[model samples]
Target chain A: MSTGRKYLLQNVAPYGGERTTVLLADGVIAAIGTDVTDDDATIIDGRGLVLLPGLVDLHTHLREPGREDAETIRTGTRAAALGGFTAVHAMANTTPTQDTAGVVEQVWSLGREAGWADVHPIGAVTVGLEGERLAELGAMAESKAQVRVFSDDGKCVHDPVLMRRALEYVKAFDGVVAQHAQEPRLTEGAQMHEGIVSAELGLAGWPAVAEEAIIARDVLLAEHVGSRLHVCHLSTAGSVEIIRWAKSRGIDVTAEVTPHHLILTDELARGYDPTFKVNPPLRTQRDVEAVRAGLADGTIDIVATDHAPHTREDKDCEWAAAAFGMTGLETALSVVQETMVDTGRLTWADVARVLSETPARIGRVSDHGRPIAVGEPANLVLVDPAARRVINPDEQATKSGNSPFRGRDLSGCVVATFLRGRATVMGGASCDEDVVARA
Target chain B: MKHLLSTGSLSHKQAVRILDTAGQMAATQAREIKKLPTLRGRTVVNLFFEDSTRTRISFETAAKRLSADVINFSAKGSSVSKGESLKDTALTLQAMGADAVVIRHHASGAPHTLAHSGWTNGAVINAGDGTHQHPTQALLDAYTLRRHLTGGGDPSGRDLAGLRVAIVGDVLHSRVARSNVQLLHTLGADVTLVAPPTLLPVGVEAWPAEVSYHLDEVIDTKPDAIMMLRVQRERMSSSGGGFFPSPLEYTRGYGLDARRLAAMPDHAIVLHPGPMNRGLEISADAADSPRAVIVEQVANGVAVRMAVLYLLLSGNESNETKVDA
Candidate 1:
């Protein structure tokens, strides 16, 4: 496919600023201003719409190569596009485990072939996410997919020595080890957040210290080895405190808060519905307030969609037997808008930074999270922040209908998503044709 | 009142009603023929996912005495993976048109899940679900307490008001203790839970009860009743790094002995939710003493369960008659 078509967006506010027309051609922003011409170009009426860089998810599970019953590259990326995400880092905890270069390449190419959002497959820090030995981290980094983020997401790298070594080893390739910080012994049979609710519910407790302890240890390990460490789904107030302390100490550490953790709490687990069940299970309302504060203060660097999808059989039964994840790709921006921007806690520019710039910088995804300016790649999303709707899982593009935000009113809608100067989503739906059929 | 899942949510009025109904059921049990015509054409399924012969037999005997056709569906060792079997078992019971399903699962909240998941339309009676709840057991314990300490022979419409109950041993893993604390408190009794600090859950302070680590101190208070919870020794080691050091050590700290039993008030009773760990949580001398009412607790269990089943099933669907024989 050739980038021959010229399209112009008229009167769109960039970063919620003054409205101006932006012209796109040759897979880049050609011009931005009133001088931008619509002659011989398709015009999109973007009056009153806010434009930002396409959302970048540092943590997403496009459960491909295995668990395709839940999601695939074609559908997950399409869902991401509909959510205004032009790039997502697919997590490493697959059946085959994306620990090898071949699997990462396969996933990256599959994303390319899908013609939706750019998919960057995260390499597993350990073999099969077993936490025993290191995977081919160097090989994955050097592969065609160029994986720079390694993680054992579903399982934590519990062995201190292994964690230390993985952190050090990734540094050689300028890579960062994304850790799922859970102390295994502390979280054994843990059904939900360890608090008054879990005690009343009679389910086993997953204590907040289980996550915070590991984060404390890993941040120290990262400092000792002079390497970068990324904490995945920081869910506890203690974790926020620990990360804040580590940053103050000048330790190279970055932390992400999931959209679910920012809004939902352990109170939802009272119904024993698995729809609310998630690993690093929802914490207390205090933890929710802490994470919101963390995100606002920049102690938490980004908001990543842990876009885990599971089939009906996986979540149809009792809470104890159900899978621990919630499909999040389609509702991420709306949730961010509802919790952060609409609450007057953050500006639209901060939203772009947290949801786009910071996450891209963390994942080392250079192509995305760029500013919507001239000569930059036209990877952008047009958002109608005033629009609100109740999320229905049935209408989502992901294969799994396990969205936890179902039946809740959320603000902001992705009116359109452009990946590299071409429309991946137009009119809030996936553009059926390929944006550019990559060779 | 559609389901008897947990006494935690049961109101004071509802608790008295169940105890009052059990008094009527207990009166009928004294007759030569205990069978009643209240549930003559109804069907009750004892859906025991976890093996509890005592609980199953009590539910079965209760259902039969009420003239409900009983089906003992002991689905123990069914696959717990994804709870396919729990749902499958419920659907099977639903297909059989069982009027009420008595469920005991190894996982906490399984009965609540079954009741709310819409797998079956029948009323769910939680027999025992992990360490979460055992409402009938608490009801029976309260009934026994009411009979001994409150209403004398016929504790009809009587609550255990102003009676102090000390629940001792393994408060962390004891569904009996969890159920009793809430039910006893709801019935207007002051409940003091006595256990080693390790045997108490993290959020025990929030429960509507007092917590004490020393059993002798609680015994010194001269409580009206001391309910000894069974210590599942297997759970001690298996549930994440041993909750206690040894049985001897646990006995020394929280066990009810002959001396402690003698320290109780003259009319006080010693109750144990059996199958008891004889020399561990309770001594032989105390368990066999005249003050001990362990055996009568079993008899009262049937009456309490009968009261729960009758209230849940006989309320709105009594007009529809079905005969199995």
Candidate 2:
């Protein structure tokens, strides 16, 4: 762990509750309530700030150890801190593919050296994400990173026997296989969502059944094997229905929705802008409404950033030619607040549950997603709920300018972020600039 | 209009104005000189990211006949691997001071991206985009239909209010079908799309055109015109050959044959945006028939493209035609 500093937060609402004083020292919540005083602490007047446990992302692409031109652990974690995330599960689809224990540990160590957020490296389920044979899941789970999550995110593990074997095998290590639900043959040359918009746009349609079919098949497979199954980036309405049905059947499946899907729709693709182009491409407004309702209820368990970053060269061309992703780490919280909180679909406490607590619980992170009590780890974020800012991708810490939310005004801002009593971000920017730069 | 990207966005007034301008441009082509100085000193770039010698030469001939400088830039490959090439090519065209860019790309929406990207100030004309829109092709087809079906050969200020047109074959991948369905509907013509179920898009019912699975059914109706789309054999292998069972089976189902040709009205014209698959989508008897306007469609394509270049480059769009054809 990096060296931490003492801090005093005065009159901040924990989980948007009554204002109270909290003290941090020795990388833990040393004291709380009135009379919590420390002379050697940096005093913060947190008026009108809603404090909550720091956000933990179940899905984030650091793009480190490869594709550093887009993002690295250092930049990605800094962006996470700015977005109020204290921990992030880096996806397995990197250059060399984070399948082995050595690679996951390397990524974990890079996150430690960055010191912005605690990086949990997710191991790949398939070797090189090829889906031909399983990777060393047992070894990676036992490694230093202790990867409990295994996934072939960019490519789906389509082979039923392989998926079944993976589902059955990961149970030995209490690991969950996060599936990127896509049927390859059904989505051949798919550019965007298969709908009226795609019909007119002339781009090949990515039918909802393509995702639903795999999700349906995998959920049944998971049930038959009786192992943990996690679905990534559930976009379509039919997908929500399937997951709801799976959950109703008491199947051990948990699903996540991205920030982009909550508000943006396939109508955005009418402009043919590649920035809106994503895998499991943005669905219609009806799908958007369905996902919002799903998340509002407990049907969708968590909200993951899926914070993919791509350089301008990848996104500045025709829709068919562009890469499939958007940068989300920086604007994730603000988007959640605008879509979930401000819309009355969720409260601040629910925000903490979906964005921080639930994700941490799902990822089996013990230190994070803890209550703001005395002697707990001080991984926290102070957000000004009334504050708002237009998202500018250039101003983001991530090296990519492919933010789909660029130029849109979003509510709430991270006033400060604390990672174990250390201010990774203060005054809406990275704290300890010189120290961070050197580290 | 700043750009002719898609016919779906074209208003009735804009569509007619273009057809009228094309009619005047067609009259000019009848002259012995067959040249115009309307777009003189203008630089028109024929940017072909997909190789279509027919489209490139047609655009080239149109630009040259208008006395505009035409530069052909062909960068052929999958747009997926040629992502940066499109942007780089656009920037290069911007640097070269192109006044109008006639683009034909393998990727759908490539022309839309170019027109709105702020990379160049040129007016973009879609020669054809990936199964998306070929606005000029649709325009020339409308011009052809109007000349033969409407107000004799001098169809000015008239739209095909009640003309029935049946567009056959590969509606799923034909940029021609997509563009024509929209433009024809805008011009008040009823369009029936006849194709195999596998060859039609999922949401094609939402389009303005009515759909038919039987070519003989549409041919039995004695539509004013039948436009046969090019059926690429590569689609057979690429789409798992699931689009149809065999060439003979497809011809038996949707092909415009000699018997189907004889069933049509005597005045009903035949249209094909060629390099025709003579024995595939259309047989030789139908393609070479006296009623077929396939060759005339090519000559009209030049006039239609010239009108587009003239209207766009002459700064006289959204107004009456000012040139004497």
Top DockQ hit: 2
Per-residue CA lDDT of model 1 for B84-170, tens digit only, reads 888888998999998899999888889988988889998888899987999899989998999899956666777888999999988
- Write down the lDDT of every candidate, Cα atoms only: 0.89, 0.90
Q: Report the poorest 10 consecutive residues by lDDT, candidate 1 chain A.
A: A430-439
The fnat of each candidate, in order, is 0.48, 0.77
Off by over 4 Å in 2: A1-4, A434-439, B77-81, B316-325
- Give the per-residue lDDT digits (tens) of candidate 2, residues A300-336: 9999988999988889888888899998988889888
Tens-digit lDDT string for candidate 2 (B1-325): 4788998888888788888888888888889998888888899999988789988899999999999998988777645366888888889999999998999988999999998899889899888999899999999999999999985756888999999999999999999999999999999999999999999998898999999999998888989999999999887777564688888998999888899999999989999999899889999999999999999999999988988888778966445542211
**What DockQ do the predictions score, one after another?**
0.61, 0.79
Q: State how far residue B145 of model 2 sits from its true place (Å).
A: 0.6
Model 2, native contacts kept: 0.77
Q: Cα lDDT for residue B140, model 2?
A: 95
Prediction-by-prediction clash tally: 0, 0
Judge candidate 2 at residue B250 and give its lDDT: 89
In terms of lDDT, the best-performing candidate is 2
